[model samples]
Target: MHGRCISCRFFANDPALIEATFPGLNVLSSAYGSVRSDAGICSRHEFFLSSWQRCRDFESGDNEGKDALLPVEKKLIGYSIGFGAVLLGILVWISYTFFPTGH
Candidate 1:
């Protein structure tokens, strides 16, 4: 099992570097279902190992995954910004129309 997992040799604490090395690669959990066992490799692990063809040093703890921003949070922020911009534009237009300009 160790031999099988040891085929790949790339591991790093930085996720951006890892991604730059392996493009179009999904995380262990996303590619593989759930990691239930402690011994065997899960889908995500398998995918990572297979795709990158490298094994990380378990002792070093350098293979920390990246912390991704949640999709919901991004969507909410976008909506809020868009809504605020529209509201501000409307308010400005209304004020300009209602208020008389001094000649």
Candidate 2:
């Protein structure tokens, strides 16, 4: 398997974006070429695959009909935000326990 199966999750359905990101790969004619098909790997496992390979049990497009790729910056931002929230919550709890409002 050249890892170009249509059912593969790494398959790029968005020709324009995929071509731009992977200039070396043929986004239009290769078996792994973008079909604009909905099929793809599950969301949970999508991040684990190499951009060059396709998943075996790919399902048709996402419900939003968009490629499931998430920008690295966006992911990082989300992580940072979540971490900050957790830290803040911990600090609030520590302060509440050590310094009661009545005292």
Candidate maximizing TM-score? 1
Q: At residue 13, what lDDT does model 2 achieve?
A: 43
How many clashes show up per model?
A: 7, 9
Q: What's the lDDT of the predicted structure labeled candidate 2?
A: 0.52
Candidate 2 worst ten-residue window by lDDT: 33-42
lDDT of 2 at 69: 59
Residue-level lDDT of model 1, residues 1-103, one tens digit each, is 2323323233222344444545574553322333322123323343433323334343333333435768998899999999999999998888788874831
- Each candidate's TM vs. the true structure? 0.33, 0.30
Write the residue-wise lDDT of candidate 2 on 1-103 in tens digits.
Answer: 3343343433444445544455665644542444534333335353423344555555543333335557987899899999999999998888889888844
Count clashing pairs, candidate 1.
7
Model 1 score (lDDT): 0.45
Q: How does each model score on lDDT? A: 0.45, 0.52
Which candidate achieves the best lDDT against the true structure?
2
